[model samples]
Target chain A: MLVTKWVHVPEKAINKPRQIEQDGVKFTQSISPWDLPQQFRFLIDAESLTIEWRYLSDSEPVKRKEFPDGFAVELGKTSSRIYKITVSLSALEKSISVMPTDEAEAATSALIKMKNALAEIENYPNENNKVAMTKTAHWWANLPNKAELLANAM
Target chain B: MLRTSLAVYGWLNWVARGYQRASSYIASSCGFFLLIDTEKSEFLSTRPVITKFVQEIQSNMFILFCLFLFLAVIAHILTKKTSLDVWKEIKFILDRYQEKCFPNNKEKDLHRVTLFRLEKHCLFRRHWSSRNWLNFRGHCRLFSNFLVPVLRSGHINGKSNTFFQVGSDQNYEGVAGLAFRQKSQVAVKNLPDLSSPLMAKVKDRKRLITEYALQTNCKRELIEKWVELGKTVPRSIAATPVEVNGQIWGVLVLDSTSPETLSSESVSDYTVVIAVIGKLLERM
Candidate 1:
C-alpha cells in the first residue's frame, strides 16, 4: 500500500473576461429594424457556456444563447474560441472570437514551466519510483522533509 | 567736319527711332494675332502663349493692364463661380475645374473642338452624356469627383457618351463587367472566395477595403491606385455599401480617372457623405 501526504494547493482562476463579437452584440426585433445593443449575463460551466439577454423584465430571459464545445478554460490562462451567430430576419451572420493578453501570457509561461517539469520527470531515475511517492512541497517547512526523503532514496 | 558729324548723328537717331517703332508695332501685332488665333488654331493649346502674352504686357503695360481689367470685370459679371460652401480656402479647386470646363462657355467650345478633332476617334456616341452625373442627381454633382471616364480623354469634351458604361451599381454583373466595358483599360477586381476563414474575419470587420469594393457595402473604385512620385491628380474611385435601416441596399460606387481621389480612407473618411447618399437613396 502507498503512503499519503498533506499539501495545500493555491487558488485557481474561476472567472474570465467575456468574449463577444468585435462589433458587440446587437438585437433587432422589428421588421424594418435598427441595430439594438444587447445587455447580457454570463453563466459558464463544465459542459456548456450560456449567455442570457433580458428584454423588458429582469427576472426572465427573452433570449438564451448557449454553446456546447466552443471554449477551453485552464486555471490562470485563457483560450479563445469562435462563435457564429445569425440574425433572424436579414440572415446576417457574424463570428466573434476573444484574445486575452495578460493572463494568457502568464498562463503560457506557467504552461511552459509545467512542460519543462514534465520533461525532467520523464528523465528521472528508475530506482525508487520517486515521483510516484512524492508530492509538491508547498511551504518552506516542508522542504527539509522533502530533501531528507530525496537523500534517503539516493 | 563738326557740321558733318552732327548730320550723321541726326541720321542715326532717325534710324533708331524707326527701328523702335517697327519693333513695337510687330510685338503688338503678334499679341493681337494670338488673342484672335486662340479661337481658330491649336496655337493657344501649346503653352508658349503665356510667355508671349507676358512679353506683350511688359512691352505695352497700359494696353495689357486695361485688357486684363476689362476681362476681369467681364469674368466677374458673367462667371457664376461655384463657391466652396460657407467661405473656406477650398474655393480654388472648384475654380480650376470650372475654369477648365467653363468661363465664357469655354467648356462648350472645347467640347466642340474635341468633337471635331475626334470625329473619327469618337468610338461611342455623338456627344458625351454626363450619365454618372445624371444618375447621382442634383447637387450630388458636388461629389462628381468620383465619376471616372475609362479612356484618358473620355472627358466631357469628347464626342458622345464614353463607351465605358459608367452606370450605377444596378448593372454590376459578375466578373469584370465594368472593366470589360472599359475594354480592360480599368478594372475593379473582387475575390470570389467568400467562404475562406480569413475572408469571414475581413467581412466581419467594419472597415472598408480599397482594392476590394464588392466585399464591403461602399461603392467607390480606387482610381489613384498607388501614389506615384510626381504631380498629384485628383481621382475619386471608391466603393461603399449603401446601408438603409441597418440593411445593405446597394453599393455607392465612385469611379474617377484621377487615382488620388479614392481610397479606403476615402470611404472611411467620408462617412457623412456615404450616409447622406444612403439616406437619399433610401428615400429614392
Candidate 2:
C-alpha cells in the first residue's frame, strides 16, 4: 500500500537516475563496498629476481571488468595463481624465477588492518579518514531517486 | 534496477489485465441481454416468438450471473493466497547488494539472533533480538520506507522486527523512535514483554526453536492484538541478538504470518550473515 505522491521537480535541477546498460554490463547508482579497492603491497626483487609491476597495472582492471561482481573465493585464489604465473613468466623473460608468498599474505593482513583502522573513521570527525568515510557514506546514502517512483502504465 | 523496472511493468500489466477483464464482464453481463431485448421489441406483434425470445434471454442472463459470481469468488480466493517467503525475497536483493559491495567476498545472510531482556522500557516488548544496530539505527527510516510493506505482506513475513534501542527519554524523538514507534505511540507501548514469552519457548535449548506463532505453548494474544490494533498482519517470528566483541548490541527479528518462514538452510545463512555483521559492528 505504498502510495505514489506527485512532487514537482524543477526543470533545471531534476537529476534523473542514470542507468548504465549498454556496455554489456549494467550497474545502478547503488554502490557496494566490494566495488571499492583496498589492500596494498610492496616488494623488492633480489639481485637475481626482477619484478613485473605491469601484471597488476594492466590485467586487474580488465579482470574486474570481466567479473564486475568481483572474484569468487575460488576465482580469487585462481587470480592470484594467474597473476603469479604472469609475474613469474615476465620475471623469467628477464632472468628471474624466485617469487615471495609473503607479499600476498602481507597484503591480506594489511587489508584487515586497514579495515579496522577505517571502520571507526566516522566517530572521529577530525581524523584523516573521515573524508573518505564521508565519501563512502555519501556514496551509499546518495543513490539517486529514492522516491517510490517508476513508469506508470495508463 | 531490473527489479524496479520489472515491478513497474508487472503492476502495469496487472492493471491492464484487470481493465480488460472488467470490459469482458460488462460485455457478457449486459451486451447479450440488451441485443435480445432490442430484437424482441421489434417482434412485439408476434406473441409466440416474443415469448420464446424472453425465455431464452432469461435463461442466458441467469447462467451469466452464475458464471460471474463463481469467477469473482475464485479470483478473490486466489488473491488471498501468498506464495512468497518475504525474507528470502529480501535476502535475494541483499545478496545482490552484498555482491556489489564486496565483489570478491561472499557473506552469509543472518539467521539466528540472540535475545536479551531490557530492564526498563520496551517499545514493542521488553525482550528484543538483534543482529546489527547499524541498519536499524542509522538507516531505519529508509528501510521502513522501502521494506516495511515488503516485509509486512510476506507470506511468512507478517511479524518481522528490525528494532533498535530508543531509551525512554527519546521515545518518539530519534531515528529509531520514528522507525519503531511511529505506528501508534500508545499502541506500541505497553505490549506484553516479547522476550519473556519467547525465552520460555526457547527454554530447553534442546527442542529446536520453531516458529513461535505456530507453537501451541506460546501466548501471542498481546502481539496479535497489537498487530490488529495497528492495522498490520499477525506475525510468527525468529528474533536474534547482534553480538559484537562478545557484548550484545541489538536484535534482528524475522517473522511471518506462518511459522514456517525460516528454513534450515536459511537459518545457516542467517548465522553467517549476522556473524559477519557482528564483526563489522565491532570495528564500528
The best candidate by DockQ is: 2
Worst lDDT run of 10 residues, candidate 2 chain B, spans B182-191
Docking class of 1: incorrect
Please report how far candidate 1 places residue B94 from its true position, in Å.
15
Tens digits of per-residue lDDT for model 2 on B152-180? 22123233443333444332221122222
Interface RMSD for each predicted structure: 20.2, 18.9
RMSD of each: 28.7, 21.0
Error of 1 at B208 (Å): 30
- Cα deviation in Å at residue B164, candidate 1? 11
Q: Chain B alone, model 1: TM-score?
A: 0.22
**Lowest lDDT 10-residue stretch of candidate 1 chain A:** A27-36
- Where is model 2 more than 4 Å wrong at Cα? A1-106, A109-116, A119-154, B1-25, B33-165, B168-251, B254-284
